[model samples]
Target: MTWRASVLTIFPEMFPGPLGMSLAGKALAEDKWALEIIDIRDFALDKHRSVDDTPAGGGAGMVMRADIAAAAIDATKARTPAGTPLLYLSPRGTPLTQGRVREIAQGPGAILLCGRFEGIDERVLEARDIEDISIGDYVLSGGELGAMVLIDAAIRLLPGVAGNEGSLAEESFAEGLLEYPHYTRPREWEELAIPDVLLSGDHKKIAEWRRAEAEKLTRKRRPDLWAKYRKS
Candidate 1:
């Protein structure tokens, strides 16, 4: 089945924005995956088409009304393949990871809810059994960017999306470590020579050097990942 991504957001135009370029764009053109955008405001009950309201018990920003949010989610769920996970992009959600992206890439698809204002009402999230996911610790104005990030990650992992499938195994987080540094022609630039081992043409030695460099960089830059790598 073609991997699919359904997004419910107040800004439908925001979708396929950056996703319409590069490898993701190529995969989309080839029908390797599909994208469906749903405008949440379209489900608003009010004649004015307002989807949000003042937060219950009073708060700083408006909360998307539960009724409208639920309606939008229900519509997406009904059309999407059964058991497709429903996700809401939020600050407090679990941090997204490469493993999660791989899981989604192998699945039929996902339904992503892009929250705005303070956020969609908690009741709607609970009622729909949606999982909240975060790309980082910091917050964005809305979930549209987060949804894009997620789709980009998943798209790149889909079959035929990447031109060099073998290279995927060596990417950062592919083996719980940062990717090793890369070098290219023009052996000398700015008085800096390409690493000697890379030019040695000794495949075994080259692999060893790359592994060591990957370990060193991961340990220095991300102790948390390094710790996990060491433990595993």
Candidate 2:
């Protein structure tokens, strides 16, 4: 089955924005995956199409109305295949990881709910079984950018999306290490020569050097990943 992604947001035009270019766009055009944008405001009950209201306990900004968001989610689910995961992009959610991206890439697809204002109502999130995920510690004006980031991450991992499958193996977080540095022609630039091992054509030595470098960089830059790598 094609990997399908449905995004529920107040701004439908925001989707396929950056996703419409690069590898994700190519994959999209090839039908490797499908994208559907659902406008949450379309589900609003009021004639003005209002989807948010004041927070129950009082807040500086409006909270997305639970009933309206739920309606949009329900409508999307009804048309989408069963078992598709539902996700909400939020600041308080679990940090997104490559492992999670891989899981979603291996699944049928996901329904992403892009929240605005303060956030969506907690009640509907529980009722719909939506999994909240955050791209990082920082916050954005809305969840559309987060949804795009997530979709792009997953799409590139799908079959035939990336041109070099081997490159994926050594990518940072792929093997719990930062990628080894690379050098190209112009062997000597600014009096700096390409690493001798790379030009020596000793495959075994090159591999060993790369591993050492990757480990060294990881240990210095991301001790957290280095610790996990050492344990594994």
Candidate 3:
């Protein structure tokens, strides 16, 4: 299924490069999905096209003007389908997960709002059915980075987006564990030899070795995800 996504941000140009440089770039040019970048500044009303204003309670940094942001959202919505779902990127939100990416991929509804400075008004969120998703628990300078992360995750799930079907199935979070180790043409590095099992020419044995390595990697690196594996 083809998914159309729009990003509302003050720095629209910052994206498409960082995100569009590698696999995401190939996916975009190939039209596996559609992407639109809208500059929030374009929707501003002043001569300077200022989109931020002083905070209401006399804070340090300027807060993004609610009305300006709301107007940008409206403009983006105009380009989307009738029921497109909007997602606002913020630190004070639920951390994004793989499940969320798959959910968005299955539906043609996902828009990302990249906020700057202090942030957008909370009223706009309360008034809409928008989803607040954070890339991580840490705070970012702006939502542009977070939006890019979301975009990449969503793109990887699209059918034919990845050249290898097995690649997707073995990616971290595709199962309950991290990806297994990979080997290339070198076969040996710094006197370290490749696993003998991999060169045995037995596909079944190779698959089993990968699964075992993935389980070990998960238990060592992410105990929390491994715990879920145990429960299941």
Candidate 4:
């Protein structure tokens, strides 16, 4: 079955933006996966088509109405395959991880809700049991970008989407450690030469070198990941 991604957002045009390029785009064109863009505004009942309003408790920004969000979600859920996850991108959500990305990629696909302004109504999220995912600690102007980030991450993992599946296993965060540095082409440049071990043409030694480098970089750059790696 084709991996599918359904995005519900007020800004429908933002979709397939970056996802419409490179490997993800190629996979989409080849029918390896599918993208569904649903405009949340279409569910608005008002003549002006307003999807958001002032917060009940009075917040700085408007909040997406629970009724409208629920309407959109319900309609989309009816079309999405059973067992597909419903996700809401937000800053307060659980940090997105490689393991989670892998799980989503392995599944049929996902329904992503892109919130705007202050965010979608909390009641709708609670009632629908939507999973909240955060790409990072920082906040963005909207969840559209986060949705794109997640879709891109999952799309690359689909079979045949990435030409070299083996390379996926070696990528950063694939093995709970940052990927090892890479080098190619010129054997020497600006006084820097390819590592002797890499030039040695010994597969075993090269593998060992890569593992050590990955470990070293993870330890220095992301102690949090290194700590987990050690525990595992």
lDDT of 2 by residue, 79-194 (tens): 88888899999999999999999999999999999999999999999999899999999999999999999999999999899989888888888987889899899999999999
- lDDT per residue for candidate 4 within 1-232, as digits (tens), equals 8899999999999978999999999999999999999999999998999999899967598999999999999999999889999999999999999899999999999999998898888999999999999999998989999999999999999999899989999999988999999999899999999899998989999999999999999999999999999999
Off by over 4 Å in 1: none
Clashing pairs in 4: none
lDDT of 1 by residue, 25-112 (tens): 8889899999999999899888999999998798698999999999888888888899899999999999999999999988998899
Best by lDDT: 4
By the TM-score metric, which is better: model 2 or model 4? Answer: 4
CA lDDT scores, all candidates in order: 0.93, 0.93, 0.86, 0.95
**How high a TM-score does candidate 1 get?**
0.99
The regions of model 2 sitting more than 4 angstroms off are: none
What are the candidates' C-alpha RMSDs?
0.7, 1.0, 1.7, 0.7
Clashes of each: 0, 0, 0, 0
Candidate 2: pairs in clash: none
Off by over 4 Å in 4: none
RMSD of 3: 1.7
Query: How many Å off is the CA of 185 in candidate 2?
Result: 2.0
TM-score of 4: 0.98
